[model samples]
Target: MNRRLLLLVPLVSALSFAAVTRVEITERGDVLQGAAFGPAGAYERVAGKVYFAVDPKLAPNRIIADIDLAPRNAEGKVEFSADLYMLRPREAAKGNGTALVEISNRGGKGLLGMFDLAAGSSDPRAPADFGDDFLLEQGFTLVWIGWEFDVPPGPRLMHLYAPVATDNGKPITGLVRSEWEGDKRVTTISLGDRNQVAYPLADPNAPENRMYVRDTVAGERRTIARDKWTFSDATHVTMESGFEPGKIYEVVYQAKDPVLAGLGPAAVRDLASYLKFGGAETPLSDEQKTTKRALAFGVSQSGRFLRTFLYDGFNQDEKNRRVFDGVWAHVAGAGRGSFNARFAQPSRDGHPFLNVAYPVDLAPFTDDDGLLKKAAQANVVPKIFYSNGSYEYWGRSASLIHTTQDGKQDAAIARDTRIYFFAGSQHGNGSIPPRSVEAQNQASVNDYRDSMRALLVAMQAWLKDGTEPPTSEYPRIGKDQLVAASALAFPKLADLHLPRIKREAYRLDFSVEPPRVGAAFPTLVPQVDLDGNETSGIKMPEIAVPLASNTGWNLRSKTIGAPDELYSMVGSWIPFPVNRTERENRRDPRMSIEERYKSKRDYLELITAAAQKLVSRGLLLDRDVAKLRDRAAKEWEYALKLN
Candidate 1:
């Protein structure tokens, strides 16, 4: 009974494992799609034959199949057959190709074997070498296992070669490998760690390193070429050329540095400093020194490599002038005349009238004197020089405008350089003069606005296409236009009574006192009309209108029903001096006591509750207008009581 049972068991087992198994592989987009046997008992019924189909859309010309088996399975014990067809096409057979089959024990313990298929005939290939001797011959140290290929321009044949260990011996996988589309053959042997692998693309023949350097200060530039031999240690030495003696030059360099093998720590530090401070002589703190030193090193190296002169220390006045000379010479040598356009004006008459309203108070916003010189050398010419009304305002109110001479250093600018003054306007407020008393009164505001617009238009035409402007129609009383005459009108320039400071002097020794309250106002009040006719008229104080309602006194308008002889009193009562003579003489406290008392009385009446409400709305705040009115009253009373 036992013998019979054993025979039946063998038969049953063979029959169970003999049935065919079906496998499917599908690919979608860049992701792989497929299914495998489950870990449970689902795959226990698998047999010797397997079949898989490829998605027709995949356009796959080859298929790779991996097979896994149990350890008890002997070598060559399992045989398999496969048939492939396109499901969508519904075709039985479209083409024929070779198939490669490899076999190994479940744990990879058995000898590796392969079979090559062609024309329906199966033939065994040699065993794999496992050492991959074919890759070694190609100067590749096999660090990993993978393959890369470049498709040829046209269809060609090529083979993937590798070695595998076999029980009998080692054999090359290329014995059965084949493919179409031949291109340049380049084999890359990957190492065990991908990071350790070196690719042929990094070879020097691929692309040589090259860069350019620009010396902005010296206005020079150069290009550098690099190759393997050129970049070797002591190979990539940087050098400067085309430098003129006695001329300061600005140099800049740029290059790519490898993290592992590029510039050393010291080189890096020096380069960093050069870029930061541009070689300033001013003493730097420890932190600043370190930073500047590093930047300099970088900039210097880049400048040297690009053959550009160092730009460091070229921003200083003396040094910058030298650099500018060098730069201009280069520009001239290249036959470029309009390379730069900076210039300076000497006196008001030598400058253009249009630029006069820009206000000297704006000078602080401009580049330092050194940079200005460089700009001039480069051909920069100022079209206008604007000054403000008085000294109690911003400092930049005294700028002079000028144009460069045809060809002379530091010569007075041409008459084409305009000079304009903002009458009753202070500092930058001249650009958009206010009509409020807190600013300039309305009539003065209108005059400044109209004049500035006209000047700008003239300048635009001059710069855009060289169109000359007609004589400026500045606001004038008789034949003379209003101008800023003293420190009161242009605070930046010292007062006439004050001593002048030489430009070359390094230190100022004079004591500066704060302007005293009720200090005399500067600037001359016009005494005639535009038509040159002498007129006696009353000057009114600018009035504040009610915010909620427009009805109120228009202080700027002429007042009627007052005695004509009283007009002089109106002019005399002004808080600030009205005429140049009065301005100069009013330093004495007793010149106009009656006028001061009358002005205070009038101011008190003007700042009523109704007036306060109106002014608060316009000024964007709710505050007591009486405060200013009371303050003005006190000042007027004090001036009147002065001996």
Candidate 2:
């Protein structure tokens, strides 16, 4: 065995499980809300008996809802099961009202129901009984509901029920909303779409066509903004909508393209300003401009802030692009009450991060990238930065590391950043991997999971602390070199370039590119038995006396080939101190592994010739090459010495 491999195996075995740990904490609660659209006085309805329960089986204590949905055909035939665990709030000042509902079936199932214990109300109301046909017409299957009363800080109980037929089909999907106190209460909502019926009378895309507004002071429903198109294009739309101290106003959005919806009434005014003075070439109409200005004025008077922004895949169609851009603008603009923009280009050398399974190399050109750049330019560095996978259905494991590195290098960043890489995570968790027999084994999937977790941990540390990260490594070649270290070896920055102005965009400055050079190869002398088979024994090659004096051996390179693969052979020397005055003073590239071995026979012949010449001249002294060769030969003999 190679000497280095012998040294590494024992160390790896010793350190394999050094950092594994197990710990547990109680699971927290999550808030739920009714669908945005429906009838007036609409509240999230629950059926059957729903009670909160704590589970000891799950780690980090889990708080779940035990629901009993009766027999489908018979009334009161109860079916009991626990659906989701509630998460704790990040801050107490923000109130314990905010909650994260663990989506059942990985968010494939819709929310069953929401109970308002704070309202001190147990009365139940169905969508059909309410005097609102709009809820049915608009296909508002689920509504996120919150209460007006203040419940004491601690574990609380509520009840909910799911309609019998709803479970037979696809699961419902929507956002979870949490309410804060005071006239400027903050409302947090999560939004998504799900289909439960095969074909409904209303547009199947009704969820996208509707928007909801709430009166913070009165705690009453305001209005629903309907789009002209059958579907809404925006995804992850976050808007800061509330009233200020002395100003009574509502934020709203209007539908532009039959498919695209504008900001609601409460947000229209500022949205309009964004479309105008925001430097966008495609400005909004005069009406929009006026509305946005008024909203801005109201916001200033009330001492309240609002902003909005959008996120979408850059390569998506125009419809998706608009939706993403609009959502990002709404969220970023509303949250910050101002605009900011930034840019980042994350690329690894040789495109090594772009493996066939996941290609993150193309992300810089996507909508997320563009939106971030725009926000940075506007001086709004968003708290949350969103990015999608480059390949249609693959993990961004490799690309994420490089991108994080690039983000760190970006000069415009003013605050720390957090990156979320979802697990079993293929292209934002929507694309599912085909279930194969091989996938049934947990070990088969461990590597991907471990890699993702490590990446996230590293990212968090980089953001929370000011530490730079070490380059990512991958297993290749041999056990000793299991984790091949990665580095930006190439000096040239062909892939790295600065943005250019209009007409001169095609030009590049070559003077800034780093220089490259040919490398030397190492010598390898294989030890074999009489059968000529390469046995499990190896040794360093003998050094030529004169050559040894000029260039001592590099032990690290001797054991392992050059960490950088630019070089070809092992122990092949290159000319040093080349004359800068001469243009043609370059050395030949090192020989390949195969050629080195092939030339070994000739090398031995030269050594023999040198040895014979020295002996004949009576110059074979203690400093002779023959003696050095003899010593190396002895080392090899001892290395191959068998028991």
Candidate 3:
């Protein structure tokens, strides 16, 4: 089957609806400096912010979204808008006709920046601008957009500027609460946490503004006088009393302008449609041959956005055509985006101290069943590839999506969907390389990059070629594989503070639609294996072979936030001894490295077999085998030296 022959014709007729203006900034072989970018002179390093405006009528459901909230845009007309940046091949004939859209994760920091650096390692700083030339090498149209309205502005960050709901153009004021944790006795603080822009009050010192202090989640909410907190600035609230470390302080103040936050979904929908089919209201690429299809990818926060985007039925554009042919959601767990609603906290996530559940990751995963009921929309579901790590099982409700609502029977995944589980890996395991020797207390050295790349190829082949990828690979509830955290028979590691509680999913009460605040319900977590590692999922060599006990849950940084509780999006890496005698001496219930493999060759051989098995099953890619084999050799050397 020829690659070009595999792609289905565009569902909607292509028109010059160029919604974006292109500004070619630089070429790869141009003035970009020292072997600047490893381009073969086929692509241009372009930079431009694509702007878009969505019609409310076109998005009839977005104004209210899934939540049954009163429309904030009193005029019933929303000024919803967002921006995006792109990188593309210079010539139409030089590249594949596929766009890889990335849902920006915390302004694109962490994971990819460290693990997937661009050619020649350009931009060696935070919020890396380039990747391992992986996307470029595939001749893909790489793009990023600002879906989060609350994220602080910075280099290459995407943002959304929306309108607050109005009652006859009158400001809608409500009790909006914000929380923060700090160690130093700071007399001042931002009203919102983590650089989030807070809602402005009609009057700073108004009697309605209030503050409270607490040491724990259950601590009594003691009221602080109006004089203690003053609106030092427009959106910033100040505290006279110093806030102590490891304690949480909250403020509920009057704020105005509740942007129809739900329009967020519409923004993603419109932008994707404009790029894939060309109807943007600006100049665009004449290379229609390479701009005919779309494949969206997101990690962690962005991954959650994909889920929410789908739940809200935003994959279908105004024309009732699919916006994305395929979507790759990584480490999103079983959760959806905290998007769409008045004062929506898109970044709140699932941690206990942070935002509790707010109708996210709800509904069964197998169907367009619960989220959208429209018959036409039901049949328009796109092909999806959801990849998550062990951290999701421990922190994000991973099992709930694939199992019965009560967390018992396994749910049948839709054939269009493939839920992959990367065992013993953290939320976004900081890197994609092999294990290092210098770091003693390091994260799980399980690399998912190569596998992810391989799966991406499989996804494209499936979407364009009418081929079926491998079946879903995740822990199952039917088998003893998926057990509750309470049943984990973990080896006793000295001084390691294990979590008694994990991030739970709740049935929050959104009684008031205008401002969807809520009370909490009971929570659920995934079951684990005897070694404390999640089983029956896609196992990397690190987890399949013996070396250390890697888990997705990590202890909170005691210096800030809720002390001793599970941290956000990070996992723990606990290593083992050389042999069984060493393990028994320390009272470790698990076997040591020596017991698992007799010699260095023995370990390498095991890793080779494991990698081959995963590759055969399509869990691991053949291209990645060499790296795993090399890692095994390195680990064996470390074992020999350490023992």
Q: What is the TM-score of each candidate against the true structure?
A: 0.20, 0.21, 0.84
lDDT for each residue of candidate 1 in 93-190, tens digit (9 for 90 to 100): 11011000111111011111100101110111121322211111111110100011111121111111111122233221110000111011222211
Winning candidate number (lDDT): 3
User: lDDT of all the models against the reference?
Assistant: 0.20, 0.21, 0.63
Worst 10 residues of 3 by lDDT: 3-12
Residue ranges of candidate 2 with Cα displaced over 4 Å: 1-86, 89-369, 382-444, 469-643
lDDT of 2 by residue, 1-643 (tens): 9843443343223211111011111222222233333222222322211111212133211111111211222332222211112211112122111111211211121122211111112222333223222212222222111110111122222212222222334332322211111122233321211111111112334343344333322224444344311222232223344222211122112211110011111122222222223323333322123211111111110101112222211111111111111111100100111111100000110111111111112223222434355445434332332221111111111222222223222112213232221111122111011112211111111011112223322333343353543232211122221111122121121222111100000112222111111221111111222211112211112222111111100111112221121111001111111122221233212222223333434545555565554344332322344443554343233222310
Which runs in model 1 stand beyond 4 Å of their true positions? Answer: 1-372, 380-412, 428-447, 470-643
Residue lDDT tens for model 3, 533-634:
666677788678857677777766545546556665666666677777888788877777777777778788888898899888776668678888887676
- Candidate 3 segments whose C-alpha is farther than 4 A from its true place: 1-41, 59-81, 109-131, 163-169, 182-185, 218-220, 225-227, 279-284, 357-369, 372-378, 430-442, 512-530, 557-563, 633-643
> Model 1, residue 390: displacement in angstroms?
6.0
Root-mean-square deviation of every model: 37.0, 29.6, 6.1
